[model samples]
Target: MDERTRADVERAEAALVEHYPHLVRLAHLVLPPSMGRHRKVLTAHGLVQRALPWRAARRAAGALPAQRGPDTAAGYDLVRQRTLELALAYEDRRRPAVLLPTVPFVWGLRLFPRAGGADELALDQALSAVPAAVRAALGLWQLEGLEPEAARAVLARAGVADPDAALRAAGQLDRRTGAGAAALLAAGEFDPCTVHVRPTDLLRRRQRARAAAALAAVLAAGAVVAALPGGQPAARPAPTAAQQALDPGRLLRTPNEEWVRTSRVDFTAWPPRGRQAGDRRLLGRALRVWAAPPPGTRIVAAAGTSTRPPAEPPRLLYAGLIDNVMVVVFHDGERLVRYAEPEGATPTLHFARTDNADLATAGALVIGRGNGWQRYLIAPWVAGVAVRDLLAPDAPPHGLHLAPDGVTDRIPLPPAGGGPCGHWPATELRTSARLESHPAVLVTDLGDLAPVHLAYAAAPAGPAAPGEANGAPALHSWARTACTLRSLRGTGVRSVSNWVYARQPLPEGGGTAEWVCNRAETWRGPGRAMVQFEPPAAGPADPGRIAGRATGTAVCGPYGRGVLGGVRWQAESGTWYLLAAGGGRVDGIDVTGGVRAGADAPTLAVPAARDAPAEVTGRLPDGGTVRALQP
Candidate 1:
């Protein structure tokens, strides 16, 4: 039976390899060009990954025989449909301001490359003008060959209000774009007949690189390690008597157990500089777009230095807000700098080379707050530090103490005291991580901290869930678990600057909220540690009650996994209420509420119950009588 299961898995894996690129192309066609091709590929891959579980579940339920392989076509269709749904939801929040032309389809075009020719450029321009929803409809119907009814279903799933209008707009877009190409397409005279590079071609390229690296590691395993990306680390001068007493590693630590810091960096040091009156105007616009300015407070711009502007123009820094955190983007000629700041706090900077030839290669590093501490997400090239003492802030600083088990010589990370920049340290380097290639280097001038060089040669890709090989905790798994424990929802990987602005629905109200996620983290104060752990406050003066019928079902699986499934709800109470499910000692409600309702709520818990539906209830703040019927 085990052998059969392994064979079945292999079959499923083979199917995935065959269908992955088509899935990616389908995703790209439907999603906005601005989302970038890397994002499209990731979305496509994630959708396909999600489908694998469902496919496996069906096989377990005997929907398919163990000997029979899963249907690749059906799976790909499901993946495409999901991508469309996600695209539609994404489009709702970030509607394109203008329509753009659909670009020329080529087999080997660079991922995320801008349109090159007149035809492709015109297509992008035309498509940009169309509403995102409409563009999605066109991609679904024309490109994916979805029936109108199926297109409507996709739109409906995405909560699009006017699917018909979207379809009409798709037709309108074709008419307005180049008449010759449009006519050819309409006449079915033009077909992009070329097959893209096969998935095996990519696999072979990666395999050859890996084989070469393995051979090199075997040949030079005992040699002196090469310099990190930042070059050879500088020698540290003798520490002062007072400085030597303090551990550099402890600097980034929470003072008195504070999860976050209060001190703000003085942005005035390199005061924002504007070149022209128009630059000042643009700066104001950027501030308005990225920051929530106080009603009447005027914003000003300044320069980083007094020197006149150089002939080679500095890149305009893009700005946006993510979960109230400010994101500032600027590209030096060589590298991209993404700076993030909490409200009124100094910024933390992450810099990476802008020279990624392959979109699949890691070109970006993300530093954002997670679970009351800073979290770093480096691309495959950047390695996490295995330090025994202080190094730098941006290289996996949060879970420093939780290094993978068996790491006896782990290096301690640099102090998190000052923000990402400033003060102390000549050069810090870590030469070992089970997964790292070269050393990870943090090169700084003795005192100046404004722009420290964080450089490390590219590292090989390791298991996404680290420490799973042994019994130790996994970094990626723990990060996700910690985020979920703090009620951070929909935590998943993303592509782009690795930064994306998105909307999350409020758990209580029916209302939705626009926020940022990919490469961003909302800084919630210290987690369970900050809670007072006191009993509920005395009842409010105005009493309230919630009484309703809650007909929900339950199912229990093996291994003590009980689920409250097929649950549906309707609210009898006129007022909003906090709802939860309880049975035995199991707790399914949070302090805020089990599940809050704007006017109604649903069963959102899997409270353990033996062979029965869990008892679900609703309550008001004043300790009012709340009852529910559970059949």
Candidate 2:
């Protein structure tokens, strides 16, 4: 290789190493938790390095390859193509808001997507698109590696008329510099390594430190250029610390003032949660039932009349609360589910889940809620139940009382043989309850109901059963188990799920049970959302126990506004498990003492026994018969 080529390679390597960390940090800021697959970043980085030949450094003492491997060359080409595609797509998406109107620059980008491969003609075209000011800035930063001021001088030679304006536009000025940097990073212009260290996102991160420091130095030295006619300093608002912290790549300050943290736990390292055949059967049944209906549809009602024919008929899945009015969700798993609503006095039908209402044939019945239990035909082939009077927009508040053991309601039905319709009652059954207010009942695996304030709690054994002993105070059983597994098996891991709850009024009027997973942890005084936990302390039995005072806070739920319920962390032999309980309840298997990993997803199981009420007996706020149901 020629000396020039070797020199170029050295420079590129230095740049890559120096800037790789920043690039990763930048990526971390932009992508969400769900998209943080490390392999993807590594692949992109490797591709970029190969595309820029200057970046590749040959081994100092190795023989040159006789010929490039077809596979290796093909891989490099593929990576380059993918990188260019992504960059172009990002540019296209942001083009409308990119203020600068440099068509020539855009044209260059369109022609030579990769910078290293561009020929003289392409470089000239690309350079033409860039304003002289931009060219100078690039030359200083990329070629000469000069400081900002020196770069300004180089830019002046390039015929940049307003050096300050150009720098400001490129995001090198006070306050707005952070915003400009973020924009450039998102545009894939900034070195990614340096950008990702800060918390939050690229959009939210401000170059506050750099901006503030530079501004302070400039002000102290009395460095002043031509001022406006009024001689007043430019009317630029100073950026606040909060604004600087607004990084889109990092966790924002949650309403509860918590920061979201991410950690990975291997699934295989954990002890297996034993699986039962009965559990599998239950899960299969639930999946089958749920899978039967298409999205946008719901099972309304089901019935089995005693006086009906002895033949076993398919169960009804949807119903309404008015005579001849019902809505049914389709069972075909392909089409969106539709809701049928009744019109006014003239028995009309309304079909939901469709954009083209005119295309709908005869409308379905509009099920109107009455003061008492009313009957309506849910669907042509199904039956269901709904609360009456509660359907009104401003109806008086009421609670849904689901019987632990199902109940049946009777309704009058038309004679099967076309005889006169008669007043008959039909029975409908449910196993869950909904409330309008915060109920006094406390549902937890831990049996304590001492009005103790708690920010979060975790139960390794799924939803705690009715008779589990409340562990002793200060004895961190969860932590101890984690330690034991880790000591005995080198690959053990632990996880915890945190739940938050608040003592507040319910939405409607009666009572309500809400759930949420803490995506972030925050600390606010009582009545504000927060997470309270004891830090780890040295101990003989288990040294990893997190020790601190029990605390609680008012927190916002990931979906709706609700108090944080519980947080569960499980440590296994392989990886740690953290389950943040939010809206839905989840189940898991227990393998030996270590909880099974990969059990984060809710497991569909057969419904609990019909006679068994899935209730968590605890203190009731009103001292009344508070009926509890599984969410």
Candidate 3:
């Protein structure tokens, strides 16, 4: 029996249903433009519907994949490959065709996708001029974010005669400089989920309508003469207009005064402040799309957040044009919703749950994100914004400009800890309550929908005493672990605080080193801690390796500061020793396994084997033992 998992009919069905619009779009783009707009639209939808494998077909196919191979057959991927193959076959004149119109064809209606801008038209024309295989490769690259190599592989599996040559041909076309292929594909011209309907042959339709009406009148007159059994309809009152299920006008609006009285400085406190906030039509569209999103709509939701529609009309947090794109934000008590539609591009919406939120977590939101920079919708309380490089602690922060709508300029990001992170960039936001200025906090984007709070605090001083983070010791502590943050990149983190938990003197005349614990709190209600032992490094810029990390344990917080970490060290005299340290929660340290050692105090240093593996634990003042966290 084949051990490799094969695509089953059930999973394929779900994928086809979920991604029907996207699959249809791919088929439509791959099909020839020679088929004309209406024919292509119908045929694309038909091909995608037919891509699903029946149970019998799946059983017959056995262990074989739908063409992209068994190694990577995400149900959607399987159907996608199958759809492309069918489209390619349908376009080929030699093969017998399978015509399917899942949606009944309306003879009097002409359907076409909404037209896009000049760039989209040019892109469509260029794509249409290429071979079907080439168009498929380009669509995969532009829409699916597949690289050329991956696109080539997918094409080869879909039975392309020469994928490399097809890609080369498509590459030769002039995609305007600075115009991204993915962004161009997002234009309205390509989406078939929603189409423009026009009456076909208007003159002929009018003639036919008149004939049908005459026939219907005669039939009704004959029926009335034969029956005479109808009772007088009771005096009826005129019907009132229906309150739309989610009326944009009926949406909950919080009074501006609510912000002043309420302690909650979250989305609920935000008053409608934008030039186009009163635009009913734009708001209605946003609300409608949120309640029942079309299959073509692109949605991004954070981890652990439910995408269920609001039970009641969501509160209008903000409605305005930001950086030329129309954006609308809604607060549904627990979650935050954002809708955006760039000019000439298809609409996209994203949201995240912000339950149990506070001022710091709700400080800034990512209104728009791009390759290297991201624009944030800063909270109203933020009086000033500045950019600071955490690596350069002594350097003054530069001003960050915000638009009238509270959307900021494209703030460039420092390189995520992919390599040697020589510089760490963060935002210093000055937030004030009603009247007085408050100490600023540094925040950074960690691939979350919102920027998370970043700060460093030393244990003896406690978590960054107001203005203390800008001081030398606090900045030094943060600088050591700032680059190490790359490991937590892309997590749905809401806030991260780094603090020195303990200070210990090393053995064999080695200098005193700081034991720090960095804790990160995520929007999903979980926290992670990274413990590091920063020995007397060559320079202040050095970020020491992680000593240990733990989840669900408050190893370095105000409540439970118990943490034990051990590392091998070599003195200037070339003698090796195992150095162990613990925070204030523990009174004793014990090292076991490959190295055997114990200390009466919170610090331990003993001569041991070079490059040894040891288990370290701590004994609290009350005699309770705590195991050390691991790497």
Candidate 4:
């Protein structure tokens, strides 16, 4: 080989050495974190060892004498073999324990193939003969290198003919194995021995092959039966008696069997037809009512209000469970929405509206332990919503929102102060205030507002008007008082505010509830200017007091329709706080409070206040100003 090639191989070897630790770290991250230190170390060592052979082989090839053609080829072959062996070993070691059951099938594929040629038919036969589950796993592993391709190639060499087929099968296997491993890891199972493949154990291999063959035969038979003539195609069996009893469609249907047969109504049909008002009441009574309004069920009119049709029944969209969390989706006709379980001492519903119409704004509501609920109006850009424990009486609540600008807002709702209702102040606010479309609002007491401050209030621009712009028919205040604001030190800011923005149709006809801003801004010091509007004392429903407190500074700025920003504020108490806000008013707060500044303290400079009412500019970490709001 030429000197140039020699140098290239040397550089690659050097890079491999440098990045060895990082590659191992990546592998560990994708694998189980709960792995024993010994296992992790062994895995890391094994991976590096495997990588070293490849690097050395490449280097050796490069150093081969230019005139020695046969010697060079032989050296290259040796390098390739060593690289493949190491990679295969590493891949085998990394196969998640949970996916070990499929190893035999994957191995079997290597031992068996259809027609032995480069023809597509042969490839098809080889793939077809493999068990579907095993095929899927191998395809993911070999082709994808959730396991190394070299390892997959080794695995596939048993039966696969086409190199491409081998690679693909390996990838499929790796993907399945990795996914199962991930699931197992998530469940806290990390013992590699539990899932490891004993390739050297001939007896174990034979046993596994027998079991796999049996399973494959049974599955094949089932498939054949499904394809047989006169056999009815498998259909989604009708809901069981218990399921039918609870199913919305079944419950909402008329009692007549003929009608049920002829109509074949499903849950998709809204506003159950042919039911009397009495029937509606009976159905409502039978259904389990949530503490809060069901998700997606819009508040067409408040509980006690004078509106058209006299009484508008609450409409539910979809209700189900996701990851042990109860989720509901419903509509008031104009909006498609969803809501999930609440976070904190307060039961909360994270909601989202998915539609382009003015009514398509999402929001959230936090129900206090005492059954009091607060609404938070989110931004239009928030596609879906979730709340983790961050800002609560105890645990913190983390919220995630997908902003319109392609950025995801990960907001941690940590307690405002060390304790509930402590002097955690706000350092900023989004200066441009616009109506939010969603049905939730954030409230904090420290900045430019009172204790128990309320932000993102979507009150009717006026008493419910008759046009589309009047906003929803009733002056529905999204649940507020759940979001707590913490203070920023020395900035004189009381608290920062972030919220989602969306426009909803007014209760009347002609206008829209325009979303003004969903942003993150800071307050400078403890002043009345930092106070926010607080709710009543009897807890929301009862009219009481709107009190304010002198917490700290208030920083307020705006994020236009599609922008997101983060702010890190250090308090005089030696605490550090990081706040991030994006287009949908999704705010993430981290209480590094009490963290000390180093000699090279990070600087935060506020931007000059804008003169234009339609524009907003905020300071960034780099001492530069970014225009976050626009007309």
**Candidate models: Cα lDDT each:** 0.33, 0.27, 0.74, 0.30
lDDT of 1 by residue, 276-309 (tens): 2123333333233222222212222111211111
Off by over 4 Å in 2: 1-4, 26-40, 54-631
Candidate 3 lDDT over 1-631, as tens digits, reads: 2222334565677788877888888888888765557767877888888777654343344455544333324678878988988888755556566555565355766778998875676577667556788888877877777888888888988889899988877666535413666777777788877899976646545655886998798678766765767634335444333224368877778786575577877777777767778999999888877766543355678767776666777788788876667888888887888888754334677877687777667778877765457788887788888887778776788998888778888887656534458788788778866724456767887766667787667656654332225567767777777887776766667778877777888776678988887888777767788888898877777888787898866556556657777777788888888877777577898888888888888888898888777888899888799877787
Location of the lowest summed lDDT over 10 successive residues in candidate 2: 442-451
Q: What is the C-alpha RMSD of each candidate to the true structure, in Å?
A: 28.4, 31.3, 15.2, 23.6
Best by TM-score: 3
Q: After superposition, how far is residue 288 of candidate 2 from its true place, in Å?
A: 20
Q: lDDT value for candidate 3? A: 0.74
- Candidate 2 lDDT over 1-631, as tens digits, reads 2223344444444554544443333322222111122222332344344434433445457655334322343333223232333322222333333122122121111111112221322233233233334433443353334577865664454344676676654443212222233333334332333222212222212344576788897785443533435455545677554433222222111121011121211111111111211232322322233323221122332111011111211112233222333332221111122233322111211212211211011012122322223232221111223231201212222333322111123322211222222211212211112212221221111101001111234333222211111223212322222221111111111112333221212222323222322222211112222223222334422322221112232223333222222223222232322322222222221111232222222211121222332222112224322111121
How well does candidate 4 match the true structure in TM-score terms?
Answer: 0.21
What tens-digit string does per-residue lDDT give for candidate 4 at 1-631?
Answer: 2233443444445555554443333333232212223333344345444443333223364455434221333333233333333333332433333211112122321111122222322232233334332333342342224455554454354233354655555345334332343332222122222233223335534655796998798678778888898775555556445334333444332232222233322222333221122343333322323222322222222112121110123345333323333444333333232334321111122222222222211222121111111123232222444442211223233455433322233232333323344222111112112323333323332211111223342222211111111122111222222232333312222223322222323222323323222122332112221212222223221211111222221213221222323233333444443322222222221112233221121111222212212222333344544333211
What is the Cα-based lDDT of residue 147 in candidate 4? 56
Candidate 1 vs candidate 3, TM-score winner: 3
Ranking of models by TM-score:
3, 1, 4, 2
For TM-score, candidate 2 versus 3, the one ahead is 3
Instruction: Quote model 3's TM-score.
Output: 0.64
